[model samples]
Target: MNFKEQLTRFPILETVAKAAAELGVEAYIIGGFVRDLILSRASKDIDVVSVGNGIELAERVAARLGPDVFVSIYKNFGTAQIRQCDLEIEFVGARKESYRTDSRKPAVEDGTLSDDQNRRDFTINAMGISLNKDTFGELVDPFEGVRDLKRKIIRTPLEPEITFSDDPLRMMRAIRFASQLNFDIEPDTFDAIIKMKERIGIVSAERISDELNKIILSPTPSYGFKLLYHAGILAIMFPEMIELLGVETIDGKGHKDNFYHTLQVLDNVAQHTDDLWLRWAAILHDIAKPATKKFDKKVGWSFHNHEEVGARMVPVIFRRMKLPLNEKMRFVKKLVRLHLRPIVLSKEEITDSAMRRLLVEAGEDIEALMKLCRADITSKNPDKVKRFLHNFDLVEQKLKDLEERDKLRNFQPVITGEIIMETFGLKPAKEVGIIKEIVREAILEGIIPNEYEPAFAYMVHEGEKLGLSVQSTGTTFE
Candidate 1:
């Protein structure tokens, strides 16, 4: 079918056609842009394949567009990219590639459009649309990409084994596409992935993490992760997560499969937010359960202090995965550590002190932590879920009331060690730290108000007990 009508939306394609014609070369809009267009998915990135010099075509197109338009060229790779308006169009010479066994990087030489299509990672992405004046909107489907698109299947253009072995990252891409588009991986292609899963070790950690992050960000992330698990890729890529799988029974009592439970929580969180790090928190919330798992005749099974252990594991996992180690990792770690706190509050009595502590610790992330806790309730029994949700609602309301009344979100003690030193005319010492801790705990424990006056009064009283006399007093602690 001709996409002439749809192609009208992107007037940029016309400019490309003009540029290609002036250069006396053939060009086609190929890869993801074509695939997404067929699926009616919005895409701002376009890939244009030229049978001749792509860099020259990009320069010509940039010149025709305007002086303001600039082409960024990577001469070593024979590719050029232009950012025009809200769209990014990359130009590359159509090429067939041969890879060394050790690297995914290919030895490239210019080839026909057919050769380029043959080298695409998946069939749907192999389809191309002509950009020449003679066949401007004609579809090129040598691999029946349109049929694969209709069938909602992910399949390689060449032999699956050959495609994956040439660049094993394509195996992850296959699962990523299936997760993003809600498509099925064809049986042969999936089998090829399992057989060649070990090849993923050669892929860079950053590259694998990029694909894993995309999978985590998909509408339903668990689908992609399950595929990775069954394909044995997850074991190779992230063994910590694989350790969370399976159930063990003792005396006919068993715990829930923490692996599947984590996936359910992941899916549940996906329904509420698109935050990648938060979803990662879900993935790791119970990651330490396997390590902490133990059984007693009375309690059946318990994963004691799993959250704390899991929190410690987050940085190691992030470091190994090549994920960012900044506040993003801290955020995920914080959530993993505190995930059980809200649930524990929901189950038991919701106290002002508990709310205060939770609010103070979670600070700006209380809402995100709450989202994770709600998602963590993955019981199959409808009644248990309903009851827990009711309790969570009560706990949530209590948090709102306490936060509004106490103003404890991002709370810090009004009294500082400097203030304590100045009041007692003392140097920096263990006494100053001790007095500061007293005032801070008093505020969180609700023994005194968080206001400066009450905290100061309490601090002076506590100082007197520490065998220190107050030399001066101020109404303002700051």
Candidate 2:
């Protein structure tokens, strides 16, 4: 098919063709831009490969575009980028790569366009559209990438084993692409990934995490993860998660496979929100079950304190996985710790006091917590799921009512430690904390209104019970 119409939408192609003509370089729009165009996928990033100096061609293109445009040159990599409007156009000389077994870094040298296409990670991405004046927009699908695109298959342009072994990260990329495109990994490609799976160890944790995040963000992440598991890359990369696999039985009591359950929860959360951290919370919500698993004669299986343990594990896991250790990590940790709270509330009678405590604890994260809790209902019985959802609605209503009345979302006691100390004619000591706790609990338990006068009266009464006298007894203790 003539891709002439597609080129018209991107007028920059004409400028590139003009630049290439002036420089006497054969240039083509290659790799992802071509693949996405063929698939009719909208892409903002355009990659152009030329037979001569890519940087020189980029300079010429930038000169033609004039001064307002921004062009960035990376001389070491022999690549240059130009930003026009919202589009990013990357220029690189066509090159071939050779890798040593110990590293993924390729020894690069300029070569023909076919050589560059041969090095692409997937057949679909190896296709290119020529930009030379005489052949402008003519597709050069040397490997019949369009046929593979129609087949919805992930295949390497070259032999799968050699393709993956040259750069093991391609194994992860293959699976990531399959997941993102909902394509099947060609059988030989799948087997090659398994064969070269051990080579993934040479890849940096950051690179692996990048691919993993892409998988996690895919419409169905489980597909990529399952491929990783079968290919044995996951075990080498994330053993802690792999540990969540399998069910162990003792005396006819067994626990559900936490691995599969985590995936189900991940998928369930995926269906609701696209927030990566929320989905991460789902993946980790039951992460500690294996560690906390126990069997009792009365109860078949129990995972006591899994939420707390999982919360504690989040920082270490994030650190190891090269994920952010900032607020995103803290958010995941908080959700993992509190994931069971809403479910417990749902199982019981929804109460204002309970909701007040939840609101105060969850604070601004209450809605995210609710989304997680609702996603956690993965029971096979449709009625059971419906019941949990209905109860969760009551719990949500209670939270809203409590928050509106008490203003307890992230609420702190109106009476401070300094107030307690000064009122009781004392220094900062254990008694101050005791008084603050009493006042806070009184408000939470509905023993007194959260207003200042009622809390002050209740605080004085609690202090008197502790054999402490307030200097301002002219007000009298309640």
* TM-scores of all candidate predictions against the true structure: 0.99, 0.96
Local distance difference test scores for all models:
0.94, 0.90
Per-residue CA lDDT of candidate 2, range 61-147, in tens? 999999887779999999999988689999999998999989899999989998999999999999999999888889999998999
Candidate 2 Cα misplacement greater than 4 A, ranges? 471-478
Every model's Cα RMSD, please? Answer: 1.0, 2.2
Which TM-score value belongs to model 2?
0.96
**Clashing pairs in model 2, backbone N/Cα/C closer than 3 A:** none
For residue 202, what is the lDDT in candidate 1?
96
lDDT of 2 at 218: 96
lDDT of 2: 0.90
User: How many clashes (backbone N, Cα, C below 3 Å) per candidate?
Assistant: 0, 0
Model 1 Cα lDDT, one tens digit per residue, 1-478: 8998899999888999999999999999999999999999999999999999999999999999999998899999899999987999999999989999899999998899999999999999999999999898999999999999999999999999999999999999999999999999999999999999999989999999999999999999999999999999999999999998999999999999999999999999999999999999999999999889999998899999999999999999999999999999999999999999999999898778888999999999999999999999988799999999999999999999999998999798888888898899999999999999889889989999988888998999999999999988854555
Cα misplacement distance, residue 364 of candidate 2 (Å):
1.0
